[model samples]
Target: MANIVIDRIRKSFGTFEALKEVSLTINDGEFVSLLGPSGCGKTTLLRIIAGLETSTSGDVLIGGKSVIGLPPKERGLAMVFQNYAVFPHMTVYENVAFGLRMQKADDARVKAQVEKAAGLLHIEQYLDRYPNKLSGGQRQRVAVARALAVEPKVLLMDEPLSNLDALLRLEMRAELKTVLQSAGTTTIYVTHDQTEAMGLSDRIAVMHNGVVEQVGTPVDVYNYPATRFVGGFIGNPPMNFIKVPVTNGQVAAGSEPLTAPEETGNEVILGLRGEAVQLAPLPLGLEMKVRVAEPMGSHLLLTGSIHDQPVRVVLPSSETVRSGDVIGLKLDPNRITWLSPESGKSFPAATA
Candidate 1:
């Protein structure tokens, strides 16, 4: 395993800039994920690190050596793509051993390595089966085994779980963590799924518009987001942002005064997660008219309009709330997030 560093990398496709001055340091034996929306340049940055796509400027270093002019093979990195790029005619053992065979490894060594990798991935029983005969998850494991057989210095994965079913993806998430930890390989993963990033990464780099918005541990990013974009992008059901005026320890929406910590201005966004908002018996909190309620097994998703503004809240399944009924909802001040209206930057509440 080797440490990877990207220094001021820039990439462009014709007139469009895909990555701009991107820089990050991935430590040796650490699993880091680059996460963002579809067009946020996460994949582009990963490709640059893998030496598959050359950056227009700046340098990429593997184990403290510059690989700017090195080809992908010379960079000593293994890449697992979104699609399981296995040969249909070849058995799983052949696919896993192909890399070693290309390097002219002896047959005995290649056979041992392939068997070890397949066993590690728990696909040893299917080693003789062709790709067309295996299931999607099995094929994915074969892809991973193939990448591991070469024993590259760094492992790069570009949404490798995108093709699996939901249950299979969950299973593979745990399997991947175990496999990588046992191998002690430094890995960089790129994905648009926030859940995957939060669950799998040691550190997450949240990217936007060809630039990194924030980098932090999963809990830090979720609890104390550095930017409004990061806060909005990393949560399920997203965050509920309400425009409120704050003045002298008080916050209000239109004429209704709400409770919040003291602040400097009269214009700020009050951000709250759906799980933070609760339905109350009293009519003292924010007065919202429910538009719809979706029962999601364990929780109820309440979609409503607060003074003509759309808002969503997640309530317990036992709470009985109907559509078109006016309800009182409370926002936990400790759970509230504050964002600057002009700069779109997050700030903590004075008491929070």
Candidate 2:
């Protein structure tokens, strides 16, 4: 296992700055994920660590030594690409043994290592099958097995589960975590899927426009987002940003005023999660006309407008409500977040 370090890495594709002084470190045996939307430079950062892409400036170190000048093969890393780059003509066993063969290991060593890796990935049963005969998840397992066969110092995965179906992807997520932990490999995963990053990673680096916005554990980034962009990006249904006129510590949503602990700016955006909007009633309430109600198996998602501004709320599936139904919602001040309109940074809000 190896600890990977990236120090102020910058990359430019002509005039387009692909990475703006990005820096992060993956500790030994730690599972870290680089997560962001497309063109955010998450993949570019991953490739830089793998030596597949050169950075315009900065340093990369593996196991406490600089690898900026090293070739990919000499970097002591194994990468699993989005496409599951397994040779279609080779059997699963042959595919897994290919790396060992390239390293000129003896037959006994290759067979032992292949057996071990296949067992780790639970793909031992399909050892004799060709890649074309394997399912997408199984093919992914073969690719993982091949990477593991080399016992790389660091493991890099680039959306390794993207090709799988929904259920298969979910299953593979659990399996991938277990396999990586058992092997004790330091991993850096890149994905655009927020759920995958939250579920699989010990820590996540949230990237935006080639810059890392925040790096934190799942709970840290989810609960106390450092920036409005993170709060908006990390959640499903996303957090609602309400344009309210602020005076002192209060926001006039409508008749009911939303107040924070201390005064923010003259015009501050209120960031509220859909789940945090209470549907019943409060002494001070904001009326919303329901535009849509979606039953999401466990929860009912309601999209509505408050004073002509859009709002979304999540209710219990047991609650029955329909479109055009006007309901009074109590915005939970404890869960309310005050954001700067210009800078998009969050500030504390008061809860009575």
At residue 141, what lDDT does model 2 achieve?
94
Worst 10 residues of 2 by lDDT: 277-286
Model 1 lDDT-worst window of ten: 253-262
Tens digits of per-residue lDDT for model 1, 1-352: 5899889999999999989999999999989999999999999888888877889999999999999888888888888989988889899899999889988999999999999999999999998888999999999999999999999899999999999999999999999999999988999999999999999999999999999988889988886677889988989777777777667657853334656544447777777788886776545677778999888889998898776778788889988888877888877767778888878877765454
Estimated TM-score per prediction?
0.91, 0.93
lDDT of each: 0.86, 0.87
Best by TM-score: 2
Error of 2 at 190 (Å): 0.6
Residue 272 of candidate 1: its Cα lDDT? 75
- Over the stretch 1-352, how does candidate 2's per-residue lDDT look in tens digits? 5898899999999999999999898899999999999999999999999999999999999999999979999999999999998999899999999988988999999999999999999999999999999888899999999999999989999999988999999999999988888889999999999999999999999999999998999977786676888888898888888877777777765456777546466777778888886666533467778999888889999998776889788988988888878887877766777777888877644442
TM-score result, candidate 2: 0.93
Off-target runs (Cα >4 Å) in candidate 2 are: 252-263, 348-352
